[model samples]
Target: MLGMSTTTGHGHGHTHDGINWAERLGHLQAIDALDRDTHADVAQRLAAGLPEGATVVDIGSGAGGMSSAFGRALAAAGGGTVVLVDAVPALLDAATAHVRAEAPAVEVVSVLADAADPALPELVPAGDLVWASGVVHHLPDQQRGVNTLARMVRPGGRLALREGGLATQCLPWDVGIGTPGLQGRLLAARESWFERMRADMPDVVRLPGGWGRALAAAGLGDVTSLGFLVDHPAPASAPARESVVNWLTFMADMAGEWLSEEDRATVARLIDPHDSAFVGNSDDVFVLSASTVHHGTRPVPPA
Candidate 1:
């Protein structure tokens, strides 16, 4: 699960709820770096059918790693504009620099706005392709969020949302420490914690059906979904190992209260570098995950 952290101000990483945005940024950067190739592939797939010099908008754009990848793809497709929108000015600044440095030919525009804001469509330009990764789920009114994104898609253009997939799996079912199936238990706790998080959100509204259906409900056409695999086999790279550890640490921390005392201790031991059970110390550690993207296109008006 992606950590939920709010970016309410500059240099102030904590929201009123006490979630640390800076720490979350570090984790996001690590994951982005580790999954660079996979992200690039996804970008290429999204960019392939775009018209030349198309305008692409990235909603809830984090450190701009994915936006940079999109810039690279756009550059390959003969240059375009990428509008990076996020609530955090710092993140937008970082993303602007990253996009410019990585895809200098592509124009970069940063919009400081929250994804949940009703005025988002007015603040941001209509996009030839709009992308929101791990964003819509955080909104209290998910359908309204999708509807707002849909409004930004120019006719005949597409809106791509990266949401829902199997959780990342790093360690084996039995880690040979604490209890067997530690990861399984952690996942269960995470589900409970997720429900609580949603309930805690202001004005939370529940919607049924998967993202594809949601897109259709939002008046988009030809909705389709695809899954991308992120697999790092045995003898994982140092970055992959680092990512795995960070991911587990974030999960453990977020769902700690729901986790059993033994499970919490097991997690601490696994992430502790000084401990022999540290995941980083193991040569067998690997990162495996699958992310899904739902695509829906704005219908062209009949002649």
Candidate 2:
């Protein structure tokens, strides 16, 4: 998905909203540091009972980390084809490289297309397993996107989409002793930015029921929703720490126009590299309060 700035009319004139490549890499690295085990476990569980040589599609495969994990799991089942789909070309490039590095045994295909585009299925083949991680919400019509994604899956195949509410997506401010509501304020800032996006982009659809209901509405059966919690108490990995630092700093930058002096001070301290209370410092532990996985299967006819 495009960064918040680009998605909300900030335009592609600037890559990553002025955030450097290191910070962007930090975000992807954070995925490995924080959710590597949880993502692998969930992918293995959901990908069970799959036939060898089956195909897998990863929608919005940012930096290809999750796609790489799925590719590795699918490779264990005698290898298969993995497709990485994303609107951004650079991301697809990174994803391709990452997937190849992680699972050389699997065939990897990269497709450049918007998740909300109706013609997506035409460009990509139907897959035995279709995975969309936080892709639907970025579309203009979430239900339409879900329906389109459902159609991309062959009968008897499974669909898994990763999404979560604010509570699950953001770390709480109370995790460290520095600022009591730093994280909470940052989340509020994110919501404020989202509101601005909604106002600016009226065509973009916002789903009320989120992923579970979207899958169900697409005629998927055996629908299930589960959540994984990543609670790193302290001494977080370098990548995870950097990711949080970048995130809080970005929020502060985005919300700078509206943030109160007190809130700004809190954000400054939270992102301060040398400050003991800084999120990315050795003393701070990065925590993903929760991460949710919603899945369902497309029904097949009886033999």
Q: Which candidate is the best by lDDT?
A: 1
Clashes within 3 Å, all models in order = 0, 1
Clashing pairs for predicted structure model 2, backbone only: 140-205
TM-score of each: 0.93, 0.84
Residue-by-residue lDDT tens digits, candidate 1, 186-254:
888889887887888888889798999999999999999889999998799899889878978888888
Q: Identify the candidate with maximal TM-score.
A: 1
TM-score of 1: 0.93
**Candidate 2 versus the native: TM-score?**
0.84
- Model 2, residue 111: distance off in Å is 0.5
